[model samples]
Each structure stands twice: as C-alpha cells, then as structure tokens.
Target: MSVTISFNNVIKKYNDKPVISGLSLDIKKGEFFTLLGPSGCGKTTLLRMVAGFNSIEGGEITFDDKVMNRITPQHRNIGMVFQNYAIFPNLSVKNNVAFGLKNRKIPKDEIERRVDHILDVVQISQFKNSMPENLSGGQQQRIALARAIVMEPNVLLMDEPLSNLDAKLRVDMREAIKLIQHEVGITTVYVTHDQEEAMAVSDRIAVMNSGVIQQVGTPREIYQRPANIFVSNFIGRTNIVERSLKKVDNRQVLIMDENYQIDLDDITQYAEEIIKVSIRPEEFTISDTSEGMAGVIQHNVFLGINVHYTVQLSNGENVEVTEESTLGEPLEPGTEVKLLVNKEKINLFHYESEKNILEGDSYAK
Candidate 1:
C-alpha cells in the first residue's frame, strides 16, 4: 500500500550555507509527485533528504505520520532508483531483483514469488536469466526499476532515472515507469531537471529554485499560470513584458515602453503600478484585418504541427508566436502581420515581489 509523505519546515545546510531552507510539502498516497528544477536548485537535495541520505538540520520528514528524521536509510523502507543503473553486472536479471529481498532474509519461496511478479510487472520477465552486460540500456533501466519495486517499500524515489538513456529510450522508459508505478500503486517522489519529463509523468510538480519551493501545482496549472518570472520562463517558452499598469476610464491598461497600450479588462484594479506579464508563444495568433498590434515577422521556422514566428513589435521588443501549420502558408521574414492575444490568458506578476497577482487577488481578503 502507498503512504503519505510530508516534509514539515525542513532545512538543510552545508557548513554555514543553507542549501534547502524551510521547505515543506505534502505528497498524497499513490501520487506521482515530481521535484523539477535546474541544477543547484536543491531538487536533488530534497529527494536525498527524503531518502535519509542527508541529515535534516531542522523540522522533520514523516511517512504516514511517523517521523523519519532520526531513522537510518535502510530502516526507512524507501525504494530508490538512481541515474546510473545500480544493478550488478555479473548478476542475472532475476538475481539483481532478488538482492533486496534476500538481504531481508525472506524465505526462498517468497523471494522467488516476489521477484517473478515484479519482473513481470516491469516487463522484464523474459530476460530473467540475462546478465546486465547482455541487456540494452532501456532493459537495464527496467531491471533497476524491478529491483527497487520488488522490495515493496512505503515510498519510491527516483533521481533522474532516465537521464542516462538515449532520447527515444527516455521517452519509452518514462512511459514504462509510469505504467509500472501505477500498477504497484506506490507513493513516488521523482527528481528531474527536465521540465518536459516532469510534465509528462507527474501528477503534480514542485518547482524549486535556490533552495526554496517556488510553486506546487498540477502540470497544467504550473505551466499555464506560473507564479513568478522564474517559473514562467523555466517551465516553457514565454515572452515577458515589463510594463506599467494605469487606470484609464475605469479599465486597467498595460503600457508598453511608454507607447502602446493594451486594455486589460480581466486584470484586477488593485494591480501594482508596474508588473510583469507572461504570454506563451501559442497564445498569440495572426489577427484578421489588423485587429490587434502590428508586428513584422523577423523570422519563421516550420515545425511539424506549428510554425514558430519571431515577431518584432514597434517598441523594438520581440515576441514569439506559434500558429498551427494548418493556418496556411508560413509567413516569410519581414512579412507584416497583426498579432492578437487571448486577454484572459495573459498572466500578471507583481513588479517588486514577482508573485502572481492573480493568485493573490483570489486569496485577498
């Protein structure tokens, strides 16, 4: 069965410097939660803390309400998959998966039964007798996964398990891992620097930066409604506008570089004087009959499903616009076009604090 994991005001430090400070999060039972961020963002640090590989300088980590701050790594009952396939090369697939159970002094029959079942679950049953050297990278990864899941720990932790695989194998193995995790129904905390990988496999993501939790939400929420400038730019391609907000006849208008103004009817009236707005590439479309801001297509690239265009506005700022390839012939460089945006989809952040103004607006009392 799966267990709920909680980190309560957790802190970690190296020498006198803090690496993870006052981090707290709850992961639901059987949920595939991911810690996503770039290197030095403390995502791996958080994962290691959960695994009992790092000491907690303050607060506590618990599994199903049981404190684990003082527990040793082996006693915590957590299964871990590493970036390097940690299976033994000389051992056959069956022996590698059985290693954990054997150490526990499980009965021979029980070990065979569990190992056989987990191998099948990971779809490596046919290679049970094959040595690690004989297996492909993806197969070896599957063996490592089988080894971890065979122990049936309370929680499963994976640290960039697919990073060593080739591009196509990463894609294939992520799908495989997701399926196996669902079958086993274990609480999982995955760590990865790849935003796309996190989005593809996680039920929810905790975006971290500089030892702090930035935003925690479902993949769609984090991507579509990022909490700040860091998340907006990190999760995907975004065009951020540093603009001023002013009330113009009962409506808020976004002023771009003291020149162009776009009416922000959906924006709250309590918006700050200056704010940052995030617009995704796919949010812009070619307007019909000059309905919106005019821009010159600086360049265009034809992707399979969409044509990406770099549009230079009159203010000398460039915006990326992605239109469906079905929209018609791709616009050539220097082509004049009118770009329209979804007003409601535009996200606004506080200029100073860089927090999501919309989220604050919802919780404002």
Candidate 2:
C-alpha cells in the first residue's frame, strides 16, 4: 500500500539555529521525489523528521491524512536506506535481509519466502549466503535496499544512499533504484547533493537552500525556467552579463551592454530595474565576425564531446560558450572571436534578487 506524505509549515532547530523553517510540501503517492541542495541545507533534517528520527518543532506531518507527529519509528510503517549500507557484518546476506521479520516474530516459513523474493528482486539471490564484507559496494547497497523494502513499508526514505559508491557504481545503482521503485510503486523521498542524480531519477525535484524551498518542479522545468536568480545559478551553468534597459516603445525595451544592444518585449510585472541578462552556455554561437560583442579567447577546454571556450569581452568580462567539437578546428587562446547570443533563449533576472525580469513567463512557455 502506497501513502501520500504532506508537511505543513514544518520547522526544525538545532542549538537555537533554524535548520528547516516553515517548510510545506505535498508528495504524491507512488511518486519518486528528490530533495536536492548543497550541504547543510536541511534536506537530511527534513528526511529524518519524516522517518521519526527527529522531532518537528512547528506545524505537522501527515501520511494518508493521519497526523504522524507522535508516531514512533518502528510504528511509522516506513523503510529507510542510509549511506553506509548498515548491514550486520557477522550475518550472511540472507540473514541480514530477514532480520526485521525475525524481530517481528514472523513465521519462519513466511520470513524465508519474503527474504527469497526480495533477494531476487534486488538481483542478489546468488550472493544470499555471502557475508556483507565479501560483497562489492554496489552489491552491499542492493542488500541494504532488499532488507528495507522486504518490510513492505508504505513509504521509503533514502538519505544519500549512493554517496559511498564509486562514480560508475553510483550511476548504475541510481538506475536500479528507479527501476525497483517503479516495479513496487512505492512512495519514495530521496535526499542527495548531486544535481545530476536528482535530474536523472526524480519525477520532480525540490531545490532547497538555507532552510527554504527555492523551487519545486519537474527536472526540465527547473532547468529551463528557474524561479529566481539562486535557482538559475544553482541548477546549471549560465553566463550572467550586466545590462541596462532603455525604453524603446510601449511594449519593447532595448537592453544595452558594453558592445551589444538587443530588444526585449513583455516586461515582468515585478521588473522595475534591469540588472543582468542570463544566457546558457549552449545558447551562443562562435563566429569570426562580431554580431555586436567582440572578445578574445582566454581558455579552451576540450571535454571530449563538447568544447568549452572562455572568452574575454572587450569590456574585460568573461563569457563561456560551448560548441560542438565537429564545428571547426579547436579555438586557441588569444584568438579573437565574435559570439552571437540567442535572443529567444535569453533570460533576464533582477540584480541579486528573487524578482525575475521575465516574471514567471520564463517557465510558463
């Protein structure tokens, strides 16, 4: 049975410092959701609250409309997988997976059936008799997952469960976890600092910073249309250039930079001051002739599939452009090049503030 989870004005504190403040979220049943942010951003704390490991100081948490504020961890009907795997070293894989059922005093035959089933589901049946120390990192993690999910909890909470694995193993484990969640249709809440992992696996992502949710959306929504400057900067790389806006007509404004003048329409309702124009690295083309801005290549990094060029504009500002490797010969440092910024792909944000010059229209269309 899957369950919907909700948080209403949730707050947490440690040493009088607010770790999570006024957080409210609704997680749908059987959805794979990820809490993504930098370290010390309160994602782990929020997960712990849901697991009944930490106390909520304000608001309430509900699972399937039942207030879970006072529920004990054992009674919450939730499974958890941690970063360290946490398997008993002395026990064989089969025994570790059956430990929870053993504690519950389940019938020996039923425990054996469930353990065998989960081991097969996690594709570790062949290693059932092996000790945890004998398994690879990925194998150990699968065992941990099997142990948790065999309990058939309504919700699953994972905290940096892949952090200890190698890069290649982390990728494989994420795919495996997603596949398993889909097969079981469990409501899952995952916490991680890796933006790529969150983007790759989650049905939706909640971006948090300093105890607040900056934005929550589908991976494409968050990447293509950020809610604010912080969201824009944090989710991916962008070239932010300062610009001043001059009224051109009733519905148009001319943006002035050091060497370029571009027209923009439909100003945001909250946009009164023009600050910076944000262009993604892939939104520009490199050419020999100047469209408006002229710059000299400062650095060129060849990253196998795509080449990155850092150019210093005439105004002494740095702009980065990513181009396909097959376009031309590699650009060398000190080479002069003109960059054409895509007008349709440009995003303007208020200077150092949450107010967007394009309002929410950036994400709407």
Candidate 3:
C-alpha cells in the first residue's frame, strides 16, 4: 500500500551551516510530488533526507504515523531510480528487473511471474534476454524502472532519471513514467532542476530556492497565482513591468509610463503605490491600431505553432510576447503596435517585499 510522507520543521546542516531549515510539507498517498529548483537549492538534499541518505538535523520525518528519522535506507521499503541507469552490466534485461525480488528470495515461479509482468508493463518485454550493453539509454532506463516497481515498494524516489537521455527520449520517457506511476499507484518523490520536466510529471510541485520552499501547488496554481515574485519568475517566463496603481473613479487603474491606463480592479483593496506587474507572454494581445500600451516591435521569431515577439515600450523597457501563428506575415521589427494586457490574468506585486499583492482565484479575493 502507498504511504503518505510528512515533514515537520525539517532541518539539514552542512558543517554547521543550515542547508534546509524549518521545512514542513505533506505528500498525499500515491501522489507524484516533485522537488524542483536550481542546483544547490536543497531539492536534492531534501530528497536524500527522505531516502535516509542524509541525516536530519532537526524535526521529524514520518511515514503515516511512524517516525522515520531513525530508519535505515534498506528498511524504508522504498525504491530508487537515478539519472544513471543503475543496471547490472553482467545481467540481461530480465535478470536486471528481477534482481530485487531475487534478493528478497521470492519463489522462483513468483519471480518469473513478476518479471514478466513488469517487463511488459514497461514495454521492454521484447528485449528481455538482451544485455544492458546492447540496449539504448532509454531501454536501459526501462530496466531500472521495471526493477524498482517489481518489488512493489510503498514509496518511489527518482532523482533526475531522464537527465542522460536525448531531448526527444526525455519527453517520451517522462510520459511513460507518468502513466506507469499512476497505474502502479505508489507515492513518488521526484527531484529535478528542470522546471518543465517537473511540471509535466508531478501531481504537485515544491519550488525550492536557497534551502527554502518558494511555493508548493499544482502546476496551474503555481503558474497563475504564484505566492511571490521569485515563484512568478521561476515557474515560467514573465514580463515584469514597473507601473503605478492609481485610484481613479474609485477604481484601481494601472498606469504605465504616464501613457497607458488600464483598470485592474474595482473591488479588491489595493493601496495606491508603484507596483510590479507580472504579465505572461501569452497574456498580451498585439495589434496595429493604437488601443493600449504603445510599443515598437524589436524582433520576431515564428515557431511552427506560435510567433514570439520582443516589443520595446515607450519607456524603453522591452517585454516578450507570444501569439498564435496566423496566415498573415510576421510583423517587421520596426513596426508600431499596441499591446493589450489581459487584466484578468496579470499579477501585481508589492514593490518592497516583492510578494504578489493579488493571490486568489481572480487576482485577489
């Protein structure tokens, strides 16, 4: 059965310097949770703590009602897959997948049955007898996964399992991993520095930085309503523009460079001050006739599905914008245009704290 993992005020230190401190989190049973961040941001440290590879300096780590701070790695009933496919070089695909069960001394018939089932589950059945040397990187990873899951461990830990594969193979394997995880129904804690990969596979993601969790939520929540500026910048690309929020007609009006005015809210309480606006590329509408913010297209690149544009606003600040590819030709670099912001989708942040001022379903409650 899958187990829920909990962390309460967990702390880890290196040479007396705290690496991860005061971290408290909960992972639901059978949830695919990812620890995402840049290197040295404590994501891997946290994962190691969960695996019992690193000692906790403070707080308790628990599996359901049982405290695991003193548990040994081998006794944790956890399976691990690493970036380097840790396949036994001397063994064939079948033996590699059955290694764990064989160690546990399961019945010969039971081992064969489990091996066959998992090889098929991972779609590596055709190469069951093939040696690790003869298989591709992707195939080797399949062996690793099949080996881990065949034991039916309650928790699965994967640390950048796709980092060694080629780009296309990474995408394919991520999809494969997601489907297999749901099918097997095991609680997962994945660690990675790749934001896109984390989002694609995780049921929920914890964004960490400098040993602190910046935010934890579903992909959509973290993207749309980030708790702070660091989170808004980390999860995806955004254009942060300095703007003044003025109360005009008793409504919150976002004033840009004394040239553009857009009403942000009429109900939510916002003190009039200089604020930072976080607008995503897709949250902008660009057109020829003047309707909103005035800007000149600086450059344009047309990808197959969308067109990317860099526009220089009147204040000389440049912002990126993305629009759907159209039948019309791409706009020239010097072309004048009007940029319309999607007020409903934009995010406002307090200048001093850099925390998102609007943090609810519709910007703010």
Candidate 4:
C-alpha cells in the first residue's frame, strides 16, 4: 500500500555546516513528488535521508505516522532506483528483477510470477532473458525500475534516473515512468536537477537551494507565480528588470520607465521606491500602436513553434519576449515595436528580502 511521507523540522549537517536546515514537507500518498535543484543543492542529500543512506542530524522523518529516523535502509521497505542503473552485468533482465525476492527466500513460483508481471508492466518483457550489456540505456533503466517495484515497497525513491539517457530518451523514459507510477500507485520521491523534467512528471515539486527548499507547489504555480527571485530565475526564462513604484496621490503607480506606467488597483501595501519584478518571456505582446513601452528589436530567432525576440528598452536594458510563430511575420532586428506587458501576471519581489511582495502566501517561508 502507498504511504504518506512527512519531514518535521528536519536538519542535516557536515562538520557543523548545515546542509539542510529545518525542512518541513508533507507528501501525500500516491503522490509523485520531486526534489529539484542544481548540483550540491542538497536534493540528493534529502533523498538519501529518506532512503536511510544518510542519517538525519535533527528532527524526524515519518512513514504513515510511524517515525523512521532510526530505521535501517534494509528494514524500511523502500525501493530505490539510482542514476547508474544498478543491474548486474552478467544477470538476465528477469534474474535481476527477481534478485530481491530470491534473497528474501520467497517462493520460487512467486518470484517468477512477480518478475513476469513487472516486466510486462514496464514494456520490457521482450528482453526478459537479455543480459544488461545487451540493453540500451533506456531499456536498462526500465529493468532497474522493474527490480525496485517488484518488491512492492511502501515508497519508491528515484535519484536522477533519467540523467544518463539521451535527450529524446530522457523525455520518453520520464513519460514511461509517470505512466508506470500511476498504474502501480506508489508514493514516489524523485530527485532531479532538470527543471523541465521535474515540471513534466511531478504532481508537486520542492525547488531546493543550499540544502533549503525555495518553494513547494504544482508545476504551473511554480512557473507562473514564483515565491522569490531565485525561484523565478531558476525555473524558466524570465526578464528581471528594475522598476519604481510611486504613491501618486493615493494609489500605487508602477513606472516601467519614463515611457510606460501602470496604475495598481488594490495592491496598496507596496510602498517601496524601487522593486525588482519578474516578467516571463511569453507574458509580453506586440502592439500595433504605442499603447505601452516602446523598444527597438535587437535580435529575433525563429524557434518553429515560437518566435523569440530581444528588445532594447530606452534604458538600454534588454528584455526577452516570445510570441506564437504563426501570429504574423517575424520582426527584423532593427524594427521598432510597442510591447504591452501583462500587468496582472507580473511578479513583484522585495528588494531587500527577495520575497514576492505581490502574493499573500510565501512558499519559501
């Protein structure tokens, strides 16, 4: 059965230097949760803690309301898929998948039945007798997954399982993993440094940095409304530009530059003179008339589905804007354009704390 995982004020350290500090998260049963960040950001460290490979320095980790901090890896009943595709070189796919059951002295017929079922579920039954050396990278990963799930552990932990595959194979494998996880209904904690991969597969993601979680939300929420400047800049392409907010009489007015201004409606809490705002590339639209900020196109590239443009503003700052390629003809480099920014979608972050000032709930905190 699937189990809920919880981290209650968890802490980890190396030589008194805190790697993970006071982390708290609740992963629902049958949820595909991901820990995503750059290298040395402590995502792997947290995953190891759950696997019982690393000891928690402080706080507690629980499985279905049962504390698991003191449980050994072997006794925890957690299955792990690693980055290296840890399959024996000489063992056939079927044998590799049945190794765990054999070690546990399960009945011979039971091992055979479980192995065959899992091989078919992973769509690698055709290669059941093939050695690991004869399989492709993607196929080998499938074998590893089959081996892990055949034991029917309470939790499944995958550490960068697709990192070794080619780009196309990575995409295909992630889709396959997503499908298999749904069918099996296992509570999974996936670790990855790729944002696109995390966004594609996770029900909810915890973006990490320096051993701390930066934000936790669904993929759309993290992409559209980031909790801080670090999250905005890390998840996708965003143009972070400096803007000024002024109290014009009673209402707050945002000055993009001397050329463009927006009147805030109910957002009266912002009183800072200068604020940093994150505007996504796809948030801007080209206008026929001078309705908004005016800029000159510096460069344009055709990306088949979308046309990417770099616009130089009056302040000499470059802003990126992407539009549907089928909208109209692509703008040339030297062309002048009026760009309209979507006011409602723009995110304002405090200059000092770097926390999002526009949103009421702060995920980082």
Give the candidate number with the greatest lDDT. 4
Clashing pairs in 1: none
Ranked candidates (lDDT, high to low): 4, 3, 1, 2
Reference-based lDDT, each prediction: 0.88, 0.87, 0.91, 0.92
- Give TM-scores for every candidate, taking all chains together and pairing residue i with residue i: 0.94, 0.93, 0.97, 0.95
Q: Evaluate candidate 4 by giving its C-alpha RMSD to the native, one decimal.
A: 2.5
Better of 2 and 4 by TM-score: 4
As for lDDT, the candidate ahead, 1 or 3, is 3
Q: Which model scores highest in TM-score?
A: 3
In terms of lDDT, model 3 sits at: 0.91
User: What lDDT, from 0 to 1, does candidate 1 have?
Assistant: 0.88
TM-score (C-alpha) between model 4 and the true structure: 0.95
Output the lDDT of residue 299, model 1. Answer: 97
Output the TM-score of candidate 3: 0.97
Q: List model 3 lDDT by residue over 213-288, tens digit each.
A: 9999998888988888998898889999888888887787888656668876532667588888899999999865
